[model samples]
Target: MNMLIFKRFSLTILILGTLVACKETNKNPQKKISETITSETQNDFLGNYVAKEYHQRTEGYDWISVAVRNKGDNTIGISVRSRADKKRPTCTFDSKAFKVNDSLYRACSNGVGILFSFKKDSLKILTEIPEQADALQFYCSGGGNFTGDYGRIEGELDSSQIDPTLFTKTLELQGIGFSVSSFARNNKKILQILPYGLEIDNSAITRTLEGSIADVEIEDLNSDGFPEILVYLSSDGSGSYGDVIGYSVNNGKSISAIYFPPISENDELKKGYMGHDEFSIIETTLAQRFPIYREGDTNANPTGGIRQIEYQLVDGEASRKFVIKNSTDFPEKN
Candidate 1:
């Protein structure tokens, strides 16, 4: 009887121990799977993102690129670059407990500051600092515009002084056909402009530029509440011909190409035909406008010649009566 009781007690203890061991074993796998899922979610957010912020007072647009990566310590590493300035600025923070709320994450260096927040899959940037009372209140929001590929940006220029019904247009040069190729305004419109012709079409919002657009600074020449388009056309891949074109948005929701001089001339200047290469517009004064073009030889050698054409707009039409040609050694001084 004593041996039977001892055996029964041993069996009961053994069963209880086995049950406890099995429970712990099952929990280990569950914990591992939960960790894996979390890791994957973090990686999905680790990539390049494009965001835009609008300045109302100055009527300027700020495009920003952000790179996020997991630091393996329950935190995320962030690197930021300005599309306007083209420099990298970096910051670090604990992302494990971070949440996008009414308040934003602020950072600054070298006279530059950025305030950002992440909401769902998109990021928002605050354009105004808290101290600036007269500053415009702008927020950058993204997502739902593309089919889960590239991001899209929409800029709302706060010109309370201007007509509220007036629309702002953003033009991006796509390529150079016999004329200039362009993808304008959130890739909604594609335009081709030649010496005396124009072609316009719609583009896929998710598509990217098939050809390289010459890197040039776009400026508002006429200050007519619109930004101009500057395109660089390359002759032989060596150098480029400068083509400067002005554009404005009409009430019909269509882009109207404002023909500036040199871009509209039927004849080339004394140096050569306007190559339609890369060019930019200079607004020296409210009354004066000049188109600066980069011209090179067929061998891509700098012919040492740059052309500056003066332009005027009267009654909503462009006039290009002044032509000034100069070499590198004798550029016309402003």
Candidate 2:
């Protein structure tokens, strides 16, 4: 009878041990599922994506790509490329994974970033550009965290868009010492206008004028009949506010820069506002406007006033015709 009791006790102990081990495994299954979800989501998010809405070379990018590189931990790298010229990628935004959802992951740096939703094969961008060093506000009104959606592109990814061949053009200029003279070449024939700087053959120069080339338009802002190369540069600080300068070509090879007064809030004249700059060839003048901001104000609630700083070609140079206070229209010639 004593032997039977001892066997029964041993069996009871074995059963209890098995039950405890199973309970422990069940308790931690959720953690394992979370890690698996992260890995899978990242893998799916790694690929090429293009903009849903059509954008020209002047407005923004035609395609944006996300590259997942193994930097010990997984990293999401984003590059915004231009449609007109291939040598144009805005900036390489490198950041680690921010948050992992069931099917999406977010990675951000500065105030600008992109979110990858794997379930939908879509990318959402939150852009908060900085103001230029010459602007008054820390950030511009038109540049804080605007949302943009993009769709996935199939295949092995268009390597062409990733590594675009930089194009070079030849031109000439006269005024040798002006600030915009940086865009003018005294000798070199091939001119490469890159996002970071201007290069004339092997002699590469960075930040020669303002910053990288944000937008390039061939409109005659100086009303010279011939198309002038209006190169819009990226802002210095953190807003979408960029500076614009014009260059007109003589014959097919000679070119010169269009000089205008500094139209920014930080200007000595204090004529412009603290906002993003927009330029257009309206009629015979260059129409310029920027959203107005007050002291200690956020971009969300600007003063609802727009600063109009129009320019016209006077004596073959861009001259500020008039600086309006809060209206889009420049003062009548009267």
Candidate 3:
């Protein structure tokens, strides 16, 4: 009876030990997963991708490139470079990436979705732009509206792909008294501008657009002594229409981006005006002129006269001063 009792106690001790060991293993499963995730991310998506077509617009050829850099602590960084001006700007932040397929992974930030497809030695990328502001949409509409299909470049990524003379021309145009190399070293990238059409008034079709910088002007839109840089940019990637942006210099150094007011396509008189208007800074107001399209007007005979739209800065926000619809307000042809 003494031996039997001793054997029974031993068996109970063995069972309890096994149960405690299994509980510990279950509690620490996440540690193993965390290690695996970090290892996989590092191996999969860190690299440089260059544009395949190089020219997003029709007239000028500017090579654009994108870089995906790991920021540690599970953060990823994305930057885009325009070879024409050597401007590489930060477009997104704190992006979490997930795998879509064996070769494709997607990461979205700031209303833009970037899909990266990896090959053995290169990467093919696709950029998607959504149509709605509150909902999610992509730019791949079988119409070639979004940019993509770039490959990986050899060596480290930098402004070496940009034309050496681009810096000189940019400084000359902006009237900045600085060396090109110094500016390049200080400013790794410039602001990248993109455009999208807004659907309004139950309009089923919205125009697709690509954007480019048309020209730059300096002015004081807020009546401050310091000049506000005005960027004369064209929407729709073509010279079809123009818009002026008001930017203030920050701390007398970096340029600040001017967030334009939302322009809709169905704003009565302002309908069909975006991407078809020319804007200029007149004193402290932004003056825009676009052809007026009456009801049932066609592109060939949009002969519904023209309209002039003016905007003023109120507390650093763009407010429409007034719109003048006239029978005649045409400007010189480009």
- Highest-scoring model, lDDT: 3
TM-score of 1: 0.30
lDDT of 3 by residue, 1-334 (tens): 2323423433344334323323422332211212212224445667777665454434445455666665322334444444545343212112234454455545543334455556654665444332322222221122232234567666664444443221111111122211111122232423332211212121211122235343344455565444455555455433256655444544344445565553453365456453465555555566665665557866544544555566665444443122332223443222
- Per-model C-alpha lDDT, please? 0.33, 0.41, 0.42
lDDT of 2 by residue, 1-334 (tens): 2323423433344334323323422332222223334335456666666665333424544444444432112334344432334443432233334334555444332222234445456665532122211121112232222235667767654544443422222222222111211232343222343221122222322334444344344444444444455655545564566576565544333455566556544453354356466554444555555556667667655553544555665443343222333334232112
The candidate that wins on TM-score is 2
Instruction: Judge candidate 1 at residue 189 and give its lDDT.
Output: 38
Local lDDT at 161 for model 1? 23
Model 2 lDDT, full chain set: 0.41
Q: How high a TM-score does candidate 3 get?
A: 0.34
Candidate 2 residue pairs in backbone clash: 129-238, 129-239, 130-238, 130-239, 131-238, 131-239, 172-255, 195-212
Give the per-residue lDDT digits (tens) of candidate 1, residues 1-334.
2333423433344334323323422322211212212213444455555543422224444344445554322234444333332222121111111212232233321112333444345554432233321121111122111101123233322223222111122223222112233444563434443321123432212222333343322334444543344443333243334443344333213344554444444344434433434232334211111223345444433333334344443224353222333322223222
lDDT of 2 at 162: 49
What's the ranking of the predictions by TM-score, best on top?
2, 3, 1
